[model samples]
Target chain A: MIEVKDLVRQFKSGDRTIKPVNGVSFELGKGQLASIVGKSGSGKSTLLSLLGALDKPTSGDVVVDGVSLAGLPDGKLTEYRRRDIGFVFQQFNLIPNLSAVDNVMLPMEFADVRKSARAQRAKELLEQVQLDPEKHSRRTNRLSGGEQQRVAIARALANEPKLILADEPTGNLDEQTGEHIIELLSSLSRDHDTTILVVTHDRGLARKADRRFRLHQGQLNEDVTAGR
Target chain B: MSVLARSVGNAFRNKIRTAAVVAVLAVAIGLALSMLVANQAVGAKVQELNASVGTTLTVNPAGGQGFEGGGEPLTAAEAATAAAVPNITSVVGTKALRLRTETTTTDTADAAAGAAQPDAGGPGGQAASVTTSLTAAVDAGTLGNRNNTGSGTGTGTTNGTEPARTFTLPITATGTAAEVDSSGKALDITSGTGLGDYSAASTKALVGTTLAEKNNLKVGSTFTIAGKTYTVAGIFDAGTTFGNNAVYLTLAEAQALAETPGELSSMVVTVNSMENVDSTKTALQAALGASKADVTQGQRNLETAVSSLNSVKGISLVAYIAALATAGLIILLIMVMLVRERRREIGVLKAIGARNRTIGLQFVLEALVLVALGSVVGAAIASFASGGIASALVSSNSSTAAGATGQRGPGGGPGGPFGGATQLLTSVTASASPGVIAAGIAAVFAVAIIGALVPALLTARIRPIEVLRGE
Candidate 1:
């Protein structure tokens, strides 16, 4: 579950203050597969970052799983991100030097998972994401765009966080791979009872989300629909 | 992965960079280790030498350190006063004299030939034609104490039969046999024997083999000096040219020949221990009253040895410090570059719940790995090279000090300049001891911790949000 009450994030650009996510408010029930769709300047990623506790808001508040992220110290925010939300990036920002299995084990390592348990969980998660066992030892750079994205998803799921915040997870993949990635993300709502929030500019990808929110000029408009 | 394993694994992420940093650090640290080993070795040698030769004091007559500068000779009575000083173990006195020879021959036919050469106060031959010039340092007590034990008699008093004139050599010669013993230092007897128990009235003498050969004299042969006739009791081989032409006799005999009675050339006072040398010398000086004698201890040689060793040690210390500083600076430079390259990874780790301390610790761990590798190599190289470097350094330093002119003889003899302290410094063997190696390892760890902290702290301040957002 997530709640946003007039969430605002501002930045100083050459003496002029600009608001990326200005006074935006929204809420989503538990186990919801959601997408925030916006153009390049629409602040969709900023909103996702706020929800993931990756950035501090200039004003207002973001609440996730009954805990507010308002005015949390940097140390606490880091902790909140670690225990609560998992993040996936558009470029599949897995550590380039690490193997696929190692990339999946990264978050679990930060969470102090035992090495054996982390390995076992990472193997299972990678398999569930459809990555071949043999390919798990391959470095992230050596993997294709589609396989890299799947490894990123496995890493996001390693800690079994209450929420998954994926920022353009399929932005660098082909259309077919993008659709496949979207399906894999959506299936998690039923398969793992996990809430997933994806930020993308593609309307087609947004259409697959169980709940959709569109952003324009730092404003949010939500659409609740039962998607097949 | 464990933090250590992961940090080690991360080191190879930039293979070229890691290898380069490690190579530079290895050389810098190796030099430092060498200096440390050398310093330890020289320091040990100095201490050992000091302990080996216990403290000694050589008390000479006033202004007798140089040649040809005659001053008031120390009196037998003043020597007695010096013996009363506390901690005085043994006080040996010597009196040297250059005497003119008178005709002396056991053979009647040769005696008749020598009678023509004139006796004492006979004629003004200027330098005494046919007169043998003999220099003798008669012991008022013993020659070298090799055969003599403490006499339990009055200080500077002869342990032998009383000489005609009351004089003294500081040595307390109270032994049974009168034949030569292997103990006499400055001179070695080649044949015959040392003096028999002779009195002030006895005419016995000890002659060097060189003088004996020149004069064709043997034990039982007779020689006369300054109108006194003497039989050769022993023949000795003085190793140096200075000692070769000399003879030894009872203090009374030598004093009678030099016509200086109740006098002493010098006195050597032995303290119980080196620690007590200075105090004993000071006490003896006070006992003797002002300016009676020049109380010189083994202090110069000790000081020379210590100063030489310290000079070498100082260089080694400087090198060690320089090496540590350079290594630290190099490590800091490399670590900064490495942290800058890994700023993104730091952000990712933070995003994954790595606390700032955790991230900083990871970088520091990586630095330790590098340091470990470099330190091991450095220590190995230093092990091979430290000893020779230390020996050469100490030898050079001590050799310079020993080469100075006007150095006193072992016992304040105005004998010659370079008499004592020549053998003080032997070749020192310096190596990397276990303690030194351990210190080097500890230093490596300290450098690693400090080197990484600066860059790691700066990296910890990087915001994951800003990094990821910019990307």
Candidate 2:
């Protein structure tokens, strides 16, 4: 469940004003599998960042799970990111020092979960991502790219967040691995009753979503009937 | 884990750097500890020496010219008045004189040989000559007859009679034997008893252990000095070599033997307490001057020498303080370098949401740990090396002085100025108190903290974003 109203995000690059996400608006209901498809420089990542509360909108409002992002304080925004939304980045930004299980347990630690329960939950999540229980103790650096991305996905789901935001989760993987990751993410959205939004330029991945939206010139347009 | 634990773990990452820093700090701490220990040991020695020697105060005659004519001995009335001053415990009167003696022999051949020598007789060859010398015989009876069988005979007689000799010796008068406990008192007898009644007329004397040993004489043994047969009543051993050369006798006996009755060369007054020594000396000097009494130059010089030594001690204190300040600066420099090298780690900790206080505490903990380690190692090393250092310093100074004066004594031999075993024992066994060790540790801690504070504050003020951007 997420909503955006006239969200605007601007960037300054050496005295030039660039509107990456300007006056953008969108809404997604609970358990919806949605995709924002756009070419390069279409503000897809910026729009996703705003919706995930990772970046503040320059103007207008973004409401996620009934909390207004535009008016939230920096501390409250960090809490929102930690507790409400799960993010899977393109590069799978897992801490290099921690093992796979430890990486998954990081968000729960930051959220002050009961210490005894965090490890168990982290282990269960790793299994959900098709990572072997034996490999849970392996450091993230020792894992393959696809395995790391799987651990990253498990870490995103550490707190069992209501909304899952994937900013090109399969962008750095091979086609077969990307398909498997997309299938896993879609299955998680359905099984966990989570609303999933993936921002990607992969048409094959976009075609699998239940709904699709095109982002162009800092605006989002719903295109339900269009397929790859 | 806590931020401090993490920082400590990170600090060990660069092992070589940490070891180098630790070694440098250890050396600095060791040097400082040695200096502090040496200073305390020297200070204690000075205090002990001062206590043993007591203080000197000289009393001079009119216009501070002291006693003028040789015959102007201090009067008994003037001495009594001086002794009456507050804090004056006891006074001993001393006198000196020059006397002459002759040589004698038992054989006619030896007498003829001595008579044939030139200047053997007085001017114009009237009779045998007499040499002006000083002798302090105990009493009239103490000088036995020269022709007695126990006395050794010379080659000639004095003025056609038996050889008569006059010897110059110092005569001192005191109330009791206890007044001469140290600095030439009655000898301590290993065997036999002390003199019977210091007022006795019989000839008795207390000879030094060294003199007794040289002449193979002990208690009850008779010896002749200046044509007098005096029985050795006791053989005493004084602790110091200088004190071992003296002979002790009662003032009355010495005066009677010297033939200088009711006369004193000097009067030594021991005060009851040191608190009023200055005022007592001043009052006594004024009284003696008013009475036209005389004093010796030795007494005056003793007073100035002690005062000058005390002033030099004050200068040594300043030197110690300057050395301490320099040690502090060295410690500070070491800590500053340590803090600067940990800046990156500090930034990383901050970015991880560590509180500023927590981060600062990590750095401070690291510094405290390092300082503690250095202090312990340094103290141990200093304790082991302090003896050698003290001996080296003292020997160097003594040898330099000896070289300048061109007076090369036995002390200038192979083992350095203080002699081998004696110098080593004195230097190495000098005590270093716990207080000195504590002060050294405290000084090192203060310097390290001051050094760490600057870099720690800068690290605490670092912003996460700027650090992450490598700005």
- Give the top-scoring candidate (TM-score): 1
lDDT of 2 by residue, A179-223 (tens): 989898888878888888998878788887878998899888889
DockQ of every predicted complex: 0.45, 0.08
Model 2: CAPRI class: incorrect
TM-score of each: 0.70, 0.52
Candidate 2: C-alpha lDDT: 0.60
lDDT of each: 0.70, 0.60
Complex DockQ, candidate 2: 0.08
Residues B1-471, candidate 2, lDDT per residue (tens digit)?
343454465456467876776676677777667766766665565454334433433333333221132223445676688778767766655432222223344455334432223223221221112221112332223343332222222333356454453322222122222324322133456666666765434467676666566557778888653456778777766665434544555555555555545544455566554445667777777767755654332222222222333333344345545544554564456546655665554443332234556656666666666677777887787778666655555455444443443434465542432232223224433344678888878877877677666656766666533333221
**Which lDDT tens digits does candidate 1 get at residues A46-131?**
88878887788888998877888887788888888888888888877788888899888888888888999999999999999999
TM-score of A-chain in each prediction? 0.96, 0.96
Candidate 1 per-residue lDDT over residues B354-405, each given as its tens digit: 8888888888888888888889888887888777667676667656666663
